[model samples]
Target: MTLAAKKKAFVELGKFLGQFASSGSAQKPDVLCNDPFFAGLENLIHTAQHHNGWYTPEQVFFAVQSWANALTPENLDQWLSRYDFAEKSPKTVALILAGNIPLVGFHDFLSVVISGHKALVKLSSNDQQLLPFLAKYLVAVAPKLNDFIEFTDGKLGHFDAVIATGSNNTARYFEYYFRDKPGIIRKNRNSVAVLTGKETREDLVRLGEDIFRYFGLGCRNVSKLFVPKGYDFKDFFEAMFAYGDIIHYEKYANNYDYNKAVFLMSRFNILDNGFLTIKEDTAYGSPISSVFYEYYDDLSDVTKRIETDRDQIQCIVSGVIDYSVPFGKTQQPELWDYADDVDTIKFLQEI
Candidate 1:
């Protein structure tokens, strides 16, 4: 399919997805292929948790709405405008996706297709259904697109390059196997927030959204915090109260109970508010029901630490810093905010 055709198909997908926002889901008449895909997507959203328990309706809808907002004509045009696609030879780019969060590897897939390359996708078993169904919608919109996309249960048959995301352990295997191919191998990374005592109640509340979204499963979720030496937890705990209802969820509650018990058994110091715990530790990745925090003597010191451990960090959430991700905006990445600071489109163009 032509780039224009692929772009147009994705725009239609954006419109179809736009109908299923978390605010309210309402079908629109202008969306293409809705007669077949609309109800199918809705039913999938309702049953997504059966496929993956982490894919709750609210989180799944949030993921859907994020893609809905992203796959727009304006966004696509603006993002693609920077690259020269003329006379580019197409290659098959294999994608090994991670299922930690919904649609985590979509940007790579979109990058490969829009750059005039074919995709051989190996979906994580935890997130096997959604992307394939969406691929079906795209193929229905533009029949030729069927030639550009493939999903396989067995080994990848043929591919020029690869883009794989996995834990630090699995990443080693990917690096060893795909060493001969031009590929982007992604490893586990976590996001952290830096805080000052000066934050307002509203800022702190929005920061809670950054911490709790996706049950702290996504790479973009802030799992750790850096606070000033004398920072107090009273106000922070009060703000996090907004997410108290999270404890009612069985899986999260189980994690909370289990992790909390483990902490107590270790006799570690922690502050709990029924739903969440904030412990003063120097770790970047934290457990689901708890967030680790460390005391920073100065903002400069924290910046230095982040720069030192840059590979372990995905996003640096902060309200005080101009360069950091805003209070609650870590999960809502723009099309151009490439993960791992790697330009995916540029990678595809070169490959």
Candidate 2:
């Protein structure tokens, strides 16, 4: 399709989504659920929440627009062209999605479909709605593409390609399972920030949002911060105080309390200043109650260290250097970027 035609369809899709966002309902198909994907989404959201999974409309908007813009035909085509999808068509791919954050796996799903391949999707229990809802919409828009996509939970037997995302342990499982197949297996990757004392209150506030959103369960959540030694924690804490409400997540709060108690009892090296807790560790993971902020002697050297560790990092949020946008917002990825650090269309074409 021409870019113009695709954009028009996207505009229509966006309008439909906006209406749904406002009405706060998805019962009727011709309305918000007109796309089959949304219908599945409605059912999925109901199921997810029913089973202790939490998703917000704001997160849904983040997912929808992120998918809409990135997976649109034009953008998909551009990414495909970079790796030559035209020469490699009809690849069958099995996608194992991650649900740590809302709709984290949709981009891989889109890459396979838009590149004209068959997708064997294994849905993550954490996220069961948006992908199916989207698949239905795509088929509705172009019925000719129906057989190109399928959703299944079975073994991805003999599939020519694979894309999987999971934790470090699960990455091992994926590597063993799909070793023969050409694929990309991504493990946990966390995003971080380097906070210079020069940051304004506004920047701190936004940075807090990046860290706290989704209760900091996402891979892109700012799990750690690099700060200059002797930095005044009060200034940063004051700006982030509004997000104290995030403590309401009973499970998350429980984690915080548990970790804090353990640290106090064991005399573990940790910093606590009433609200946020700090610990020093080189691991990409962070505890629920607190984020780890380490002191850096020199900004440039520390930035270089982070660059060396980029494989473990998803994106960095900072005022000093250009980085991909912050976490929570990472789900709303743009058209150009690829997820799990893999090129989608290239894999699809080969299949």
How much lDDT does each candidate structure score?
Answer: 0.91, 0.69
**Which candidate number has the best lDDT?**
1
Number of clashing pairs, model 1?
0
Cα lDDT of model 1 by residue, 1-351, tens digit: 578888999998899899996677887888888888888988898898998988988999999999999999999999988888886678999999999888888899899888889999999999998999999998998888898999999988989999999999999999999999999999988999999999999989999999999999999999999999989999999999999989988999999999999999999999999999889898899999999999989888998999999999999888766469988898999999999899999888787
lDDT tens per residue, model 2, 221-264: 78888889888888878877878866665666787888899888
- Model 1 misses residue 230 by how many Å? 1.1
Error of 1 at 333 (Å): 0.2
Quick one: best TM-score, which candidate?
1
RMSD of each: 1.0, 3.6
Off by over 4 Å in 2: 1-15, 22-47, 56-58, 68-88, 269-275, 322-331
Candidate 1 achieves a global lDDT of 0.91
Provide TM-scores for the models. 0.98, 0.84
